[model samples]
Target: MKEQYMITHEPPNPVDYNNLRLEGGMSGKSREASEEGLKNSLFVVCVYDEETFIGMGRVIGDGGTFFQVVDIVVKPGYQGQGLGKLIMEHIMNFLEKHTYPDSYVSLIADGSADKLYKQFGFSYTYPKSRGMYRKY
Candidate 1:
Protein backbone atom coordinates (compact mmCIF):
# COMPACT_ATOMS: atom_id res chain seq x y z
CA MET A 1 0.00 0.00 0.00
CA LYS A 2 1.07 3.58 -0.52
CA GLU A 3 2.09 5.78 2.41
CA GLN A 4 -0.75 7.40 4.34
CA TYR A 5 1.08 10.47 5.51
CA MET A 6 1.75 13.69 3.64
CA ILE A 7 4.06 16.48 4.77
CA THR A 8 3.31 19.96 3.52
CA HIS A 9 5.08 23.26 3.91
CA GLU A 10 2.00 25.07 5.10
CA PRO A 11 0.52 26.24 8.38
CA PRO A 12 -2.68 24.75 9.63
CA ASN A 13 -5.73 26.96 9.71
CA PRO A 14 -6.24 28.85 12.97
CA VAL A 15 -8.98 26.57 14.25
CA ASP A 16 -7.07 23.45 13.30
CA TYR A 17 -3.94 24.87 14.86
CA ASN A 18 -5.73 25.58 18.15
CA ASN A 19 -7.46 22.20 18.18
CA LEU A 20 -4.23 20.36 17.41
CA ARG A 21 -2.43 22.20 20.21
CA LEU A 22 -5.06 21.00 22.68
CA GLU A 23 -5.02 17.51 21.19
CA GLY A 24 -1.25 17.50 21.57
CA GLY A 25 -1.55 18.55 25.25
CA MET A 26 -0.52 22.14 24.78
CA SER A 27 -2.19 25.47 25.40
CA GLY A 28 -4.69 26.80 22.87
CA LYS A 29 -4.42 30.16 21.21
CA SER A 30 -7.12 32.58 20.22
CA ARG A 31 -8.11 32.59 16.58
CA GLU A 32 -6.89 36.13 16.02
CA ALA A 33 -3.56 35.45 17.66
CA SER A 34 -3.11 32.14 15.93
CA GLU A 35 -3.89 33.67 12.57
CA GLU A 36 -1.49 36.54 13.03
CA GLY A 37 1.23 34.41 14.53
CA LEU A 38 1.03 31.84 11.74
CA LYS A 39 1.05 34.55 9.11
CA ASN A 40 4.38 35.73 10.47
CA SER A 41 6.03 32.33 10.55
CA LEU A 42 9.20 32.04 8.49
CA PHE A 43 8.58 28.39 7.78
CA VAL A 44 6.01 25.75 8.71
CA VAL A 45 5.75 22.01 8.33
CA CYS A 46 2.38 20.31 8.57
CA VAL A 47 1.72 16.61 8.51
CA TYR A 48 -1.55 15.12 7.44
CA ASP A 49 -3.00 11.66 7.54
CA GLU A 50 -4.72 11.51 4.18
CA GLU A 51 -6.47 14.89 4.53
CA THR A 52 -6.66 15.45 8.29
CA PHE A 53 -4.08 17.65 9.89
CA ILE A 54 -2.30 15.68 12.60
CA GLY A 55 1.03 17.35 13.38
CA MET A 56 2.93 20.54 12.75
CA GLY A 57 6.04 22.58 13.59
CA ARG A 58 7.05 26.14 12.82
CA VAL A 59 9.96 28.59 12.77
CA ILE A 60 9.14 32.16 13.68
CA GLY A 61 11.15 35.30 14.36
CA ASP A 62 12.64 38.44 12.84
CA GLY A 63 13.92 36.21 9.98
CA GLY A 64 17.55 37.31 10.32
CA THR A 65 18.80 37.94 13.83
CA PHE A 66 16.65 35.49 15.78
CA PHE A 67 14.56 32.41 15.20
CA GLN A 68 12.50 30.21 17.48
CA VAL A 69 11.23 26.73 16.96
CA VAL A 70 7.66 26.51 18.19
CA ASP A 71 4.35 24.74 17.94
CA ILE A 72 6.03 21.38 17.52
CA VAL A 73 3.12 19.08 18.16
CA VAL A 74 1.71 15.77 17.06
CA LYS A 75 -1.64 14.40 18.12
CA PRO A 76 -1.57 11.99 21.06
CA GLY A 77 -2.48 9.11 18.79
CA TYR A 78 0.35 10.14 16.46
CA GLN A 79 3.06 10.58 19.05
CA GLY A 80 5.94 8.04 19.17
CA GLN A 81 5.54 7.32 15.47
CA GLY A 82 8.40 9.61 14.39
CA LEU A 83 6.08 12.41 13.28
CA GLY A 84 7.81 14.95 15.54
CA LYS A 85 11.21 14.19 14.16
CA LEU A 86 9.85 14.28 10.63
CA ILE A 87 8.48 17.72 11.30
CA MET A 88 11.81 18.83 12.75
CA GLU A 89 13.62 17.60 9.69
CA HIS A 90 11.68 20.01 7.55
CA ILE A 91 12.21 22.86 10.02
CA MET A 92 15.92 22.14 10.17
CA ASN A 93 16.16 22.27 6.39
CA PHE A 94 14.59 25.72 6.39
CA LEU A 95 16.89 26.91 9.16
CA GLU A 96 19.94 25.54 7.44
CA LYS A 97 19.09 27.61 4.40
CA HIS A 98 18.08 30.83 6.15
CA THR A 99 20.03 31.16 9.39
CA TYR A 100 23.44 32.79 9.61
CA PRO A 101 26.29 32.51 12.12
CA ASP A 102 24.93 35.34 14.23
CA SER A 103 21.36 34.05 14.17
CA TYR A 104 20.13 32.66 17.48
CA VAL A 105 17.78 29.70 17.42
CA SER A 106 15.93 28.52 20.48
CA LEU A 107 13.04 26.50 21.75
CA ILE A 108 11.48 25.88 25.18
CA ALA A 109 11.24 22.14 25.51
CA ASP A 110 8.67 20.60 27.81
CA GLY A 111 9.07 17.52 29.97
CA SER A 112 10.80 14.65 28.17
CA ALA A 113 10.55 16.47 24.91
CA ASP A 114 13.88 18.12 25.72
CA LYS A 115 15.50 14.85 24.77
CA LEU A 116 14.08 15.14 21.28
CA TYR A 117 15.40 18.68 20.94
CA LYS A 118 18.80 17.55 22.16
CA GLN A 119 18.91 15.13 19.24
CA PHE A 120 18.89 18.21 17.03
CA GLY A 121 21.85 19.78 18.88
CA PHE A 122 19.89 21.82 21.41
CA SER A 123 21.45 22.16 24.85
CA TYR A 124 20.31 23.64 28.11
CA THR A 125 21.23 27.28 28.62
CA TYR A 126 21.14 27.24 32.40
CA PRO A 127 23.86 28.43 34.82
CA LYS A 128 25.18 30.77 32.17
CA SER A 129 21.70 31.95 31.14
CA ARG A 130 18.19 31.06 32.22
CA GLY A 131 14.90 31.31 30.39
CA MET A 132 12.25 33.59 31.86
CA TYR A 133 8.96 34.59 30.38
CA ARG A 134 5.91 36.69 31.19
CA LYS A 135 2.76 35.42 29.53
CA TYR A 136 0.03 37.94 29.08
Candidate 2:
Protein backbone atom coordinates (compact mmCIF):
# COMPACT_ATOMS: atom_id res chain seq x y z
CA MET A 1 0.00 0.00 0.00
CA LYS A 2 1.14 3.49 -0.75
CA GLU A 3 1.76 5.45 2.41
CA GLN A 4 0.41 8.91 3.03
CA TYR A 5 2.94 11.13 4.71
CA MET A 6 3.12 14.56 6.33
CA ILE A 7 6.17 16.68 7.02
CA THR A 8 6.63 19.04 9.95
CA HIS A 9 9.20 21.58 10.93
CA GLU A 10 8.97 20.69 14.60
CA PRO A 11 11.04 17.72 15.72
CA PRO A 12 9.19 14.64 16.93
CA ASN A 13 10.52 15.48 20.38
CA PRO A 14 13.54 17.21 21.82
CA VAL A 15 15.01 13.88 22.81
CA ASP A 16 13.93 11.90 19.80
CA TYR A 17 17.39 12.63 18.50
CA ASN A 18 18.69 10.32 21.15
CA ASN A 19 15.63 8.11 21.30
CA LEU A 20 15.59 7.62 17.55
CA ARG A 21 19.36 7.36 17.24
CA LEU A 22 19.58 9.93 14.46
CA GLU A 23 23.15 11.08 15.01
CA GLY A 24 25.23 11.69 11.86
CA GLY A 25 28.71 10.73 13.05
CA MET A 26 30.55 7.44 13.54
CA SER A 27 28.52 6.95 16.69
CA GLY A 28 25.46 8.74 18.03
CA LYS A 29 25.91 11.69 20.31
CA SER A 30 25.21 11.59 23.98
CA ARG A 31 21.70 12.54 25.02
CA GLU A 32 22.80 15.94 26.27
CA ALA A 33 24.49 17.01 23.03
CA SER A 34 21.62 15.72 20.96
CA GLU A 35 19.07 17.58 23.05
CA GLU A 36 21.05 20.80 23.03
CA GLY A 37 21.52 20.62 19.26
CA LEU A 38 17.83 20.21 18.64
CA LYS A 39 16.88 22.91 21.07
CA ASN A 40 19.25 25.35 19.46
CA SER A 41 18.69 24.50 15.83
CA LEU A 42 16.83 26.83 13.56
CA PHE A 43 15.17 24.16 11.45
CA VAL A 44 14.09 20.54 11.68
CA VAL A 45 11.84 18.40 9.49
CA CYS A 46 10.28 15.16 10.52
CA VAL A 47 8.38 12.93 8.10
CA TYR A 48 5.69 10.65 9.35
CA ASP A 49 3.54 8.01 7.75
CA GLU A 50 0.47 7.93 9.92
CA GLU A 51 2.16 7.57 13.31
CA THR A 52 5.42 5.93 12.30
CA PHE A 53 8.32 8.25 11.59
CA ILE A 54 9.75 7.35 8.22
CA GLY A 55 12.31 10.09 7.87
CA MET A 56 13.90 13.26 9.24
CA GLY A 57 16.26 16.18 8.40
CA ARG A 58 17.64 19.25 10.10
CA VAL A 59 19.68 22.41 9.52
CA ILE A 60 22.19 23.63 12.06
CA GLY A 61 24.67 26.48 12.50
CA ASP A 62 24.64 30.18 13.18
CA GLY A 63 21.29 31.30 11.76
CA GLY A 64 22.50 34.53 10.19
CA THR A 65 25.78 33.66 8.46
CA PHE A 66 26.04 29.90 7.98
CA PHE A 67 23.75 26.94 7.76
CA GLN A 68 24.50 23.28 7.23
CA VAL A 69 21.87 20.72 6.32
CA VAL A 70 22.36 17.56 8.32
CA ASP A 71 20.81 14.27 9.39
CA ILE A 72 18.76 13.66 6.24
CA VAL A 73 17.56 10.08 6.50
CA VAL A 74 14.76 7.81 5.32
CA LYS A 75 13.72 4.51 6.83
CA PRO A 76 15.22 1.59 4.90
CA GLY A 77 11.96 0.14 3.69
CA TYR A 78 10.90 3.51 2.34
CA GLN A 79 14.01 3.82 0.20
CA GLY A 80 13.80 4.29 -3.64
CA GLN A 81 10.73 6.45 -3.28
CA GLY A 82 10.71 10.21 -3.78
CA LEU A 83 10.56 10.86 -0.04
CA GLY A 84 14.13 12.12 -0.02
CA LYS A 85 13.15 14.74 -2.52
CA LEU A 86 10.18 15.69 -0.43
CA ILE A 87 12.33 16.00 2.66
CA MET A 88 14.92 18.06 0.79
CA GLU A 89 12.29 20.21 -0.84
CA HIS A 90 11.24 21.21 2.64
CA ILE A 91 14.86 21.99 3.48
CA MET A 92 15.16 24.12 0.37
CA ASN A 93 11.95 25.86 1.19
CA PHE A 94 13.16 26.63 4.70
CA LEU A 95 16.40 28.03 3.33
CA GLU A 96 14.46 30.14 0.87
CA LYS A 97 12.42 31.65 3.65
CA HIS A 98 15.17 32.14 6.20
CA THR A 99 18.54 32.41 4.49
CA TYR A 100 20.01 35.89 4.32
CA PRO A 101 20.81 37.07 0.79
CA ASP A 102 24.52 36.34 1.11
CA SER A 103 24.44 33.52 3.59
CA TYR A 104 25.67 30.07 2.64
CA VAL A 105 23.55 26.94 2.89
CA SER A 106 25.25 23.59 2.44
CA LEU A 107 24.95 19.85 2.84
CA ILE A 108 27.21 16.83 2.57
CA ALA A 109 25.46 14.95 -0.20
CA ASP A 110 26.01 11.23 0.04
CA GLY A 111 26.30 8.41 -2.48
CA SER A 112 24.32 9.17 -5.64
CA ALA A 113 22.19 11.79 -3.93
CA ASP A 114 24.34 14.63 -5.25
CA LYS A 115 22.37 14.36 -8.47
CA LEU A 116 19.17 14.94 -6.55
CA TYR A 117 20.58 17.90 -4.60
CA LYS A 118 21.90 19.46 -7.82
CA GLN A 119 18.37 19.90 -9.04
CA PHE A 120 17.84 22.17 -6.05
CA GLY A 121 20.90 24.33 -6.91
CA PHE A 122 23.55 22.60 -4.81
CA SER A 123 26.99 22.14 -6.42
CA TYR A 124 30.19 20.36 -5.61
CA THR A 125 32.75 22.47 -3.76
CA TYR A 126 35.55 19.92 -4.30
CA PRO A 127 37.89 21.83 -6.59
CA LYS A 128 37.10 25.24 -5.23
CA SER A 129 37.01 23.95 -1.66
CA ARG A 130 37.44 20.58 -0.08
CA GLY A 131 35.16 19.08 2.57
CA MET A 132 37.07 17.75 5.56
CA TYR A 133 35.88 15.95 8.63
CA ARG A 134 37.31 15.37 12.09
CA LYS A 135 36.61 12.09 13.82
CA TYR A 136 36.73 11.71 17.58
Candidate 3:
Protein backbone atom coordinates (compact mmCIF):
# COMPACT_ATOMS: atom_id res chain seq x y z
CA MET A 1 0.00 0.00 0.00
CA LYS A 2 1.17 3.50 -0.78
CA GLU A 3 1.46 5.69 2.27
CA GLN A 4 0.08 9.21 2.18
CA TYR A 5 2.05 12.11 3.59
CA MET A 6 1.41 15.80 4.13
CA ILE A 7 3.88 18.52 3.38
CA THR A 8 3.53 22.00 4.85
CA HIS A 9 5.58 25.15 5.06
CA GLU A 10 5.39 25.03 8.85
CA PRO A 11 8.11 24.41 11.36
CA PRO A 12 7.81 21.39 13.57
CA ASN A 13 7.56 21.81 17.32
CA PRO A 14 10.73 21.55 19.38
CA VAL A 15 9.97 18.04 20.54
CA ASP A 16 9.37 16.85 17.03
CA TYR A 17 12.50 18.59 15.80
CA ASN A 18 14.70 17.04 18.43
CA ASN A 19 13.15 13.62 18.01
CA LEU A 20 13.53 13.66 14.28
CA ARG A 21 17.13 14.80 14.49
CA LEU A 22 18.08 12.08 16.90
CA GLU A 23 16.14 9.48 14.97
CA GLY A 24 17.88 10.52 11.80
CA GLY A 25 21.32 10.18 13.47
CA MET A 26 21.89 13.92 13.74
CA SER A 27 22.78 15.58 16.99
CA GLY A 28 19.86 16.59 19.11
CA LYS A 29 19.78 20.25 20.07
CA SER A 30 18.42 21.52 23.36
CA ARG A 31 14.75 22.29 23.42
CA GLU A 32 15.39 25.98 23.93
CA ALA A 33 17.83 26.07 21.06
CA SER A 34 15.45 24.21 18.81
CA GLU A 35 12.66 26.60 19.70
CA GLU A 36 14.80 29.64 19.05
CA GLY A 37 16.13 28.23 15.79
CA LEU A 38 12.70 27.44 14.44
CA LYS A 39 11.49 30.87 15.45
CA ASN A 40 14.26 32.43 13.40
CA SER A 41 13.93 30.31 10.28
CA LEU A 42 13.64 32.04 6.90
CA PHE A 43 11.57 29.11 5.67
CA VAL A 44 10.56 25.66 6.97
CA VAL A 45 9.01 22.59 5.41
CA CYS A 46 7.63 19.66 7.38
CA VAL A 47 6.39 16.31 6.14
CA TYR A 48 3.89 14.32 8.12
CA ASP A 49 2.17 10.98 7.94
CA GLU A 50 -1.28 11.96 9.08
CA GLU A 51 -0.59 13.74 12.39
CA THR A 52 2.87 12.23 12.90
CA PHE A 53 5.87 14.31 11.92
CA ILE A 54 8.16 12.28 9.67
CA GLY A 55 10.53 14.73 8.05
CA MET A 56 11.52 18.39 8.08
CA GLY A 57 13.97 20.90 6.60
CA ARG A 58 14.66 24.58 7.23
CA VAL A 59 16.59 27.53 5.85
CA ILE A 60 18.07 30.11 8.16
CA GLY A 61 20.18 33.22 7.78
CA ASP A 62 19.87 36.95 7.11
CA GLY A 63 17.30 36.21 4.38
CA GLY A 64 19.08 38.60 2.06
CA THR A 65 22.72 37.87 1.28
CA PHE A 66 23.23 34.66 3.25
CA PHE A 67 21.27 31.49 3.84
CA GLN A 68 22.07 28.02 5.13
CA VAL A 69 20.11 24.84 4.74
CA VAL A 70 19.86 23.25 8.15
CA ASP A 71 18.23 20.32 9.92
CA ILE A 72 17.23 18.26 6.91
CA VAL A 73 16.00 15.01 8.50
CA VAL A 74 13.60 12.19 7.97
CA LYS A 75 12.58 9.57 10.47
CA PRO A 76 14.50 6.27 10.15
CA GLY A 77 11.54 4.27 8.94
CA TYR A 78 10.76 6.91 6.38
CA GLN A 79 14.23 7.59 5.04
CA GLY A 80 14.20 6.06 1.56
CA GLN A 81 10.75 7.01 0.38
CA GLY A 82 11.58 10.21 -1.54
CA LEU A 83 10.49 12.36 1.40
CA GLY A 84 13.93 13.93 1.58
CA LYS A 85 13.71 14.97 -2.05
CA LEU A 86 10.27 16.41 -1.44
CA ILE A 87 11.64 18.46 1.42
CA MET A 88 14.54 19.71 -0.70
CA GLU A 89 12.22 20.60 -3.56
CA HIS A 90 10.28 22.84 -1.22
CA ILE A 91 13.46 24.36 0.20
CA MET A 92 14.73 25.14 -3.30
CA ASN A 93 11.38 26.62 -4.23
CA PHE A 94 11.52 28.90 -1.23
CA LEU A 95 15.07 29.94 -2.06
CA GLU A 96 14.28 30.59 -5.68
CA LYS A 97 11.42 32.90 -4.79
CA HIS A 98 13.03 34.70 -1.87
CA THR A 99 16.73 35.01 -2.64
CA TYR A 100 18.50 37.47 -4.90
CA PRO A 101 21.23 36.71 -7.43
CA ASP A 102 24.00 37.75 -5.05
CA SER A 103 22.73 35.71 -2.14
CA TYR A 104 25.02 32.99 -0.80
CA VAL A 105 23.33 29.74 0.18
CA SER A 106 25.17 26.90 1.86
CA LEU A 107 24.80 23.55 3.57
CA ILE A 108 27.23 21.13 5.27
CA ALA A 109 26.40 17.77 3.85
CA ASP A 110 27.02 14.74 6.06
CA GLY A 111 28.23 11.43 4.63
CA SER A 112 26.40 10.36 1.48
CA ALA A 113 23.84 13.09 1.85
CA ASP A 114 25.98 15.32 -0.36
CA LYS A 115 24.57 13.53 -3.37
CA LEU A 116 21.08 14.61 -2.41
CA TYR A 117 22.07 18.25 -2.09
CA LYS A 118 23.92 18.01 -5.40
CA GLN A 119 20.64 17.16 -7.09
CA PHE A 120 19.45 20.64 -6.15
CA GLY A 121 22.56 22.47 -7.44
CA PHE A 122 24.59 22.48 -4.24
CA SER A 123 28.26 21.93 -5.04
CA TYR A 124 31.39 21.25 -3.06
CA THR A 125 33.09 24.38 -1.70
CA TYR A 126 36.49 22.81 -1.23
CA PRO A 127 39.40 24.33 -3.20
CA LYS A 128 38.00 27.85 -3.51
CA SER A 129 36.71 27.93 0.09
CA ARG A 130 36.12 25.35 2.77
CA GLY A 131 33.20 24.76 5.07
CA MET A 132 34.15 25.70 8.60
CA TYR A 133 32.24 25.44 11.86
CA ARG A 134 32.99 25.80 15.55
CA LYS A 135 31.38 23.53 18.12
CA TYR A 136 31.32 24.79 21.65
Candidate 4:
Protein backbone atom coordinates (compact mmCIF):
# COMPACT_ATOMS: atom_id res chain seq x y z
CA MET A 1 0.00 0.00 0.00
CA LYS A 2 1.42 3.31 -1.07
CA GLU A 3 0.94 6.23 1.26
CA GLN A 4 -0.22 9.55 -0.04
CA TYR A 5 1.90 12.56 0.82
CA MET A 6 1.52 16.16 -0.24
CA ILE A 7 4.58 17.96 -1.55
CA THR A 8 4.22 21.70 -1.63
CA HIS A 9 6.36 24.69 -2.45
CA GLU A 10 4.95 26.29 0.67
CA PRO A 11 7.45 25.81 3.49
CA PRO A 12 6.51 24.65 6.93
CA ASN A 13 5.86 27.07 9.74
CA PRO A 14 8.66 27.87 12.16
CA VAL A 15 7.50 25.36 14.73
CA ASP A 16 7.13 22.68 12.11
CA TYR A 17 10.54 23.51 10.71
CA ASN A 18 12.20 23.10 14.08
CA ASN A 19 10.21 20.02 15.07
CA LEU A 20 10.57 18.14 11.81
CA ARG A 21 14.33 18.57 11.82
CA LEU A 22 14.58 17.14 15.29
CA GLU A 23 12.12 14.38 14.38
CA GLY A 24 14.33 13.42 11.47
CA GLY A 25 17.49 13.27 13.64
CA MET A 26 18.79 16.57 12.36
CA SER A 27 19.90 19.38 14.63
CA GLY A 28 17.43 21.84 16.03
CA LYS A 29 17.20 25.53 15.32
CA SER A 30 15.37 28.19 17.26
CA ARG A 31 11.91 29.07 16.01
CA GLU A 32 12.95 32.68 15.81
CA ALA A 33 15.89 31.76 13.60
CA SER A 34 13.75 29.54 11.41
CA GLU A 35 11.15 32.21 10.97
CA GLU A 36 13.70 34.68 9.76
CA GLY A 37 15.72 32.26 7.65
CA LEU A 38 12.79 30.63 5.87
CA LYS A 39 11.69 33.96 4.51
CA ASN A 40 14.89 33.99 2.44
CA SER A 41 14.48 30.56 0.87
CA LEU A 42 15.33 30.46 -2.79
CA PHE A 43 13.09 27.44 -3.13
CA VAL A 44 11.59 24.98 -0.69
CA VAL A 45 9.55 21.79 -0.95
CA CYS A 46 7.76 20.58 2.13
CA VAL A 47 6.21 17.13 2.50
CA TYR A 48 3.14 16.37 4.51
CA ASP A 49 1.38 13.21 5.61
CA GLU A 50 -2.20 14.37 5.81
CA GLU A 51 -1.75 17.60 7.77
CA THR A 52 1.39 16.45 9.55
CA PHE A 53 4.69 17.78 8.33
CA ILE A 54 7.12 14.95 7.59
CA GLY A 55 9.87 15.97 5.29
CA MET A 56 11.40 18.95 3.50
CA GLY A 57 14.21 20.12 1.24
CA ARG A 58 15.33 23.66 0.60
CA VAL A 59 17.56 25.52 -1.81
CA ILE A 60 19.30 28.66 -0.62
CA GLY A 61 21.79 30.90 -2.30
CA ASP A 62 22.37 34.33 -3.75
CA GLY A 63 19.96 33.59 -6.65
CA GLY A 64 22.85 33.11 -9.03
CA THR A 65 26.38 31.63 -9.24
CA PHE A 66 25.86 29.43 -6.16
CA PHE A 67 23.04 27.31 -4.80
CA GLN A 68 23.22 25.18 -1.69
CA VAL A 69 20.80 22.30 -1.20
CA VAL A 70 19.97 22.23 2.49
CA ASP A 71 17.71 20.70 5.12
CA ILE A 72 16.80 17.54 3.21
CA VAL A 73 15.10 15.63 5.94
CA VAL A 74 12.48 12.88 6.23
CA LYS A 75 11.07 11.83 9.56
CA PRO A 76 12.63 8.74 11.15
CA GLY A 77 9.50 6.68 10.52
CA TYR A 78 9.46 7.79 6.90
CA GLN A 79 13.03 6.94 6.05
CA GLY A 80 13.62 4.63 3.05
CA GLN A 81 10.23 5.59 1.66
CA GLY A 82 11.47 7.56 -1.37
CA LEU A 83 10.52 10.89 0.19
CA GLY A 84 14.05 12.18 -0.10
CA LYS A 85 14.11 11.52 -3.81
CA LEU A 86 10.78 13.23 -4.21
CA ILE A 87 12.14 16.25 -2.41
CA MET A 88 15.18 16.26 -4.64
CA GLU A 89 13.08 16.05 -7.78
CA HIS A 90 11.39 19.30 -6.89
CA ILE A 91 14.67 20.87 -5.86
CA MET A 92 16.25 19.87 -9.14
CA ASN A 93 13.34 21.25 -11.09
CA PHE A 94 13.86 24.59 -9.39
CA LEU A 95 17.56 24.51 -10.17
CA GLU A 96 17.02 23.50 -13.78
CA LYS A 97 14.76 26.41 -14.40
CA HIS A 98 16.73 29.03 -12.50
CA THR A 99 20.39 28.12 -12.76
CA TYR A 100 22.76 29.53 -15.32
CA PRO A 101 25.50 27.53 -17.03
CA ASP A 102 28.01 28.65 -14.44
CA SER A 103 25.79 28.09 -11.47
CA TYR A 104 27.10 25.69 -8.83
CA VAL A 105 24.79 23.48 -6.78
CA SER A 106 26.32 22.04 -3.65
CA LEU A 107 25.37 19.90 -0.66
CA ILE A 108 26.94 18.08 2.24
CA ALA A 109 25.66 14.51 2.25
CA ASP A 110 25.75 13.04 5.71
CA GLY A 111 26.51 9.30 6.10
CA SER A 112 25.29 7.12 3.20
CA ALA A 113 23.00 9.75 1.75
CA ASP A 114 25.68 10.61 -0.79
CA LYS A 115 24.48 7.67 -2.87
CA LEU A 116 21.15 9.36 -3.39
CA TYR A 117 22.70 12.63 -4.52
CA LYS A 118 25.04 10.80 -6.89
CA GLN A 119 22.04 9.50 -8.80
CA PHE A 120 21.11 13.09 -9.51
CA GLY A 121 24.50 13.79 -11.21
CA PHE A 122 26.30 15.25 -8.17
CA SER A 123 30.02 14.69 -8.08
CA TYR A 124 32.24 15.13 -5.11
CA THR A 125 35.03 17.66 -5.23
CA TYR A 126 38.13 15.93 -3.97
CA PRO A 127 41.85 16.00 -4.74
CA LYS A 128 41.25 19.49 -6.02
CA SER A 129 38.98 21.96 -4.23
CA ARG A 130 37.67 20.93 -0.82
CA GLY A 131 34.72 22.26 1.14
CA MET A 132 35.00 24.36 4.27
CA TYR A 133 32.27 25.45 6.63
CA ARG A 134 32.02 27.22 9.94
CA LYS A 135 29.46 25.45 12.10
CA TYR A 136 28.86 27.09 15.43
Structural similarity to truth (TM-score) of each candidate: 0.96, 0.86, 0.96, 0.95
Off by over 4 Å in 4: 1-3
Stretches of model 1 off by over 4 angstroms after superposition: none
lDDT (tens digit, per residue) of candidate 4 on 1-136: 1468877998789999999988888899988889988999999999889988889999999999999999999989888889999999999999999999999999999889999999899989877788888977
* Candidate 2 colliding pairs: none
Number of clashes recorded per candidate:
0, 0, 0, 0
Q: Against the correct fold, how does model 1 do in TM-score? A: 0.96
Off by over 4 Å in 3: 1-3
- For residues 80-103, write the lDDT of model 3, one tens digit per residue: 888889999999999999999999
Show the lowest summed lDDT stretch of 10 residues, model 2.
Answer: 18-27
Better of 1 and 4 by lDDT: 1
| Overall lDDT per candidate, in order of appearance | 0.92, 0.79, 0.91, 0.91
The global Cα lDDT (0 to 1) of model 3 is 0.91
Query: Could you give candidate 2's per-residue lDDT for residues 57-104 as a string of tens digits?
Result: 889989889999987777767767888788898888999999899999
